[model samples]
Target: MNYTQNEKIKQVDEKTLVVGVDIAKETHYARTFDNRGIEYGKVIKFNSTREGFESFEKQIKEIAEIIGREKIIIGIELTGHYWYTLANYVNKKEMMLVQVNPYHVKRAKELECTK
Candidate 1:
């Protein structure tokens, strides 16, 4: 199902911990932000492996604990076919995963630069 821009924005709230990820072939980068887009921690680079995924989960749990948020929404752009494995892993963990459109990401970046 496709959600409108407003609908997507409504999914996140004060209790939501939003994570924006830049997925790559081997390593993926992620940063945690609040519902209002305030970043909470430094960027983390985790490899595409079981251990790496565990580490990423650990980091997310730690952040959630610190911020007192149980809901996590992970957003990632579909970079070729690299997201399937990670997406499956994330699904197994029961965390909410969202696929971001690359065009929207590009537009968001451009909008940010104008600010």
Candidate 2:
């Protein structure tokens, strides 16, 4: 997806989960942020298989239930066929899956290190 820099205020609730996921060839890495963009959990690592999906669903569901959330916004840095499986799983789970550019990841990492 084409991305352009834009400044806007993001209003999020305490239960909102903004997730950044790094999908690998056989595994994935994810970090979750709360409404205030605060890191509420540690980086979660899981495989890229049915078992992995099940585990992820279990943990995410538990978190959502505890926080009373009905929606999950997930982002991953992969495109085309590479993300089909993950996107399909997200869709099956009724979660919102968005394609994130790797450039954004690089920028975020830069911002994180400087902060």
Candidate 3:
């Protein structure tokens, strides 16, 4: 399915919790945000193992419950080949996982650094 930028933006609503994950070879970092781009909690650092994925899942669920959101959309950066296992894990856990473009992350990092 193809989605325009506006269509993609419209998917997130007040009942949604968006989690962006920075994938790495051994570890990953994640942050949560609401529909309006307001961050919800601290950065979570978890390993790439099954245990790590479980922990990440718990964190996401906890945040959603705390914020009273019923939907979760996890966005993961497409970094190397390390994402397969994590993707499978997330899918098995019945949550939506969206692959994000690395270029977008790069540009965001550049903007962050300059600020």
Candidate 4:
């Protein structure tokens, strides 16, 4: 299932909620965004433990309900082994998880800052 950039972009629509997470060894930070890149809530800081994942899931569900979006796509930077736990948790929860390139994320941040 290979997707071109355009196809990948098309996957997000008005009914979709995108979650971008910055994974760390112990804690993770997440933000919710709409298909047009508008943020919906504050940054969520959750630990890497199961309790933390549960908290994260709760927040995501609340946000989605508030925003009236049913589809969730969680994206995380593909770092070290720290992301494995989160990936598995997201999979078990039956949500779509996207692994992003760390370098690409860094470069995008740099470009954003220069704007």
Q: Write the per-residue lDDT of candidate 4 for residues 1-115, one digit (tens) a residue.
A: 7999999998899999999999999999999999999999999999999999999999999999999998999999987889999999999999999978889999989999995
The whole-model lDDT of each prediction reads 0.92, 0.72, 0.92, 0.95
Clashing residue pairs, backbone N/CA/C < 3 A, model 4: none
What digit string (tens of lDDT, one per residue) describes model 1 on residues 42-106?
99889999998999999988998899987999999997998888899999999999989999999
Candidate number with greatest TM-score: 4
TM-score of each: 0.92, 0.78, 0.90, 0.95
Tens digits of lDDT, candidate 3, 6-103: 98887889999999988889999999999998999999999999899999999999999999999999998876898898899999988988988889
Model 4 misplaced stretches (Cα beyond 4 Å): none
Candidate number with greatest lDDT: 4
Q: Residue 65 in candidate 4 has what lDDT?
A: 98
Clash pairs detected, candidate 1:
none
RMSD of 1: 1.5
Query: How well does candidate 4 score on lDDT at residue 66?
Result: 98
Output the lDDT of residue 115, model 3: 53
After superposing candidate 1, which stretches have Cα over 4 Å from the reference?
1-7
